[model samples]
Target: MTKIKICGLMTIEDIDAVNQAKPDFAGFIFAGGRHHIDLDQAIKLREHLDPRIISVGVFVDAPIEEILKAVNSGAISIVQLHGNESEEVVDYLHDKNIKVIQVFNPTDEKFNTGADYTMLDSDSGEILDWKNLLIIPDILAGSINSANVDKAIKIVKPKIIDVSRGVETNGKKDINKIRQIVNEVHNS
Candidate 1:
């Protein structure tokens, strides 16, 4: 089965809604953005989540110390790097026994570097050049929704699929859209 990850979760309500939706992974953005959450709020949200669901921390060029602090607080499992972090950073996180997911635009050649996983996002909601990603493994396409997720899956055949803005309607996640995207991915 293709793994589904719902990113950019912000509030307790969002957490509850996503928990009800039952995605394989729920992401918390600790970096500054519309979806950013504080450490305390992430801990509070993590407390309410079921053990079967994985909680991920999203960071963008944050200090390794700060990332470690979030990991220690409530982000016990995965960390997704959405900025220009070095392979050394990934190695350090790996040494600490934390799963690292590196994010990149399709044109970035560094995606092939060592990391537990690599995600490709359509740099401005535009579809990526899938032909350039033939040999990459354990890749997940971001900015995916029910509309283009099937195309991404068919072209990339990624082991995982991640959606954030695509699943949202008016700044809130749509459960039916999440279900639709997941279903289409599986069926494809």
Candidate 2:
């Protein structure tokens, strides 16, 4: 089955919606962006999250200390590195029993970084050419929503489908959009 990941969750309402929608993963961006949340905010939000849903912390070349703080505080269970983090960083996180998802662009020739999982993202709000890409990713992201989710699944056959803006309305996470995308991914 293709699991669903609702990314960039920054509010208790978002967490509440995901709990109802029942996505497999809920992502929080610690990196500076529109959806970014502070450590304190993440901790508070995690309190409302469904225990069955995994929390993914998205970082962009963040310090290991900061990453550890999130995991140790019980805010995030998995780390998704979205920058030029070294394989040693991945190894370090793994040593601490933290699962890691290494993000790579479609233009990158190599995908292996010794992380627990691989995530492919264009980061450009445009879906990648999955068929032309050489490997089947563990997670596929970038402009994914209910409309194109089925096509993405058919082409990539990814283990997880990640969505952020696609599940948003006016730059905020919309419950209806989340539910619609979740249904699409699960049915696919």
Candidate 3:
């Protein structure tokens, strides 16, 4: 089955909606940026989530110490490195029994060999080449919506699919849209 992951969740409401949707993974951004969430907030959200759903912490080029802090805080079971982190970092985390996901911007080509999963996203919500990723077991992101999701999935057949801005309407996530995307992924 193609797992679905919803990223950049920022509120209790968002968490509630995502939980209702029952995606395989719910991502919380912990790195310093617009989508960032503090440890306390993430911990509170984590506590409310069903254990069946995996909690993922999104980070970008953070030091191992900082990543460890997130793990210890109960913010995440999986770590997603969205910046220029090294393979050694992925290896070290895996050694500690932490699953590591590596994110690749559409233009990056140096694939890290040790990551548990690889995710492809556009810098902006623009579409990118899905064909180039056909061989990789990855998560497809960037401008993915109910309309184009089937096409992307048919071409890439990723192990998982992720969406953030694509599932939102009027700057907020729409439950109907989330359902549509999830349904389309499963049906396709």
Candidate 4:
């Protein structure tokens, strides 16, 4: 079955919702976007997260020190790189035994290629041409929701289905949306 990740979680309420929904992974955007949460807040949120579900820290052009701090704090178990992180950086993180997910645009040639996982996105929230791409078991992200999730799974067949805005209502995580999306992907 395809795994689900509800990304960009901000509040304790979001954590509680994810606990109920029980998605495979929950994301915390620490790169200071609209869903950005501070280290202290992330620590608090981690206390309430379901232990079975993995916690991922979404980063873009951030320092390794900060990423290490989050990982060491037990708030984040994985790091998803959404910036122009070099293979060296990936190696550095991997050398420390930290799991990494490298984000790609599908057209970007400069990639870390050594990531445990790769997230493919158009940044426009539409599913990319999976046929044009090679390799399976990659994570598909951007603009994924309940409506198109089934199609994405059957067509794209991504190892993991990732969503953030698609599971939100008025810029916050919605439990119903999260559950619906997960069910749709799983059923597909």
Top-TM-score structure, candidate number: 2
**Where is model 4 more than 4 Å wrong at Cα?**
134-137
Task: Please write out the lDDT profile of model 4 over residues 1-188, one tens digit for every residue.
Answer: 88998888888889888898888998888998688899998888888999998999999989999999999999999999999888888999999999999998867766567999988888776767766765454899867788888877887788899999999888878889988887787777
Q: Name the Cα RMSD for model 2.
A: 0.9
In candidate 3, position 105 carries an lDDT of: 80
Supply the TM-score for candidate 2: 0.97
lDDT of 3 at 144: 84
RMSD of each: 1.9, 0.9, 1.6, 1.5
Q: Can you list the residue pairs that collide in candidate 2?
A: none
Instruction: Quantify all predictions' global Cα lDDT against the true fold.
Output: 0.80, 0.91, 0.84, 0.87
lDDT string for model 3 (1-188, tens) is 78888888888877888777888898899787667888888999888876788999999888899899989888799999989999899999999999999988866767786899988888776897788753365788878888888888888888889888888878877888877777777667
Q: 1-188 in candidate 1: lDDT tens per residue?
A: 77788888877777777777777888898889788888888888899887788999989999999999988886548998989998899999999999999888766755636788877776587666776764454656655678877777777788888888888889887777777776776677
Best by lDDT: 2
How well does each candidate superpose onto the true structure, as a TM-score?
0.90, 0.97, 0.93, 0.94
- Per-residue accuracy of model 2 over 1-188 as CA lDDT, tens digit each: 89999999998899999999999999999999898999999999999999999999999999999999999999999999999998999999999999999999888887655988999998787878877986678999988888889999998999999999998889888999999989888877
* Candidate numbers sorted by TM-score from highest down: 2, 4, 3, 1
lDDT of 1 at 142: 50
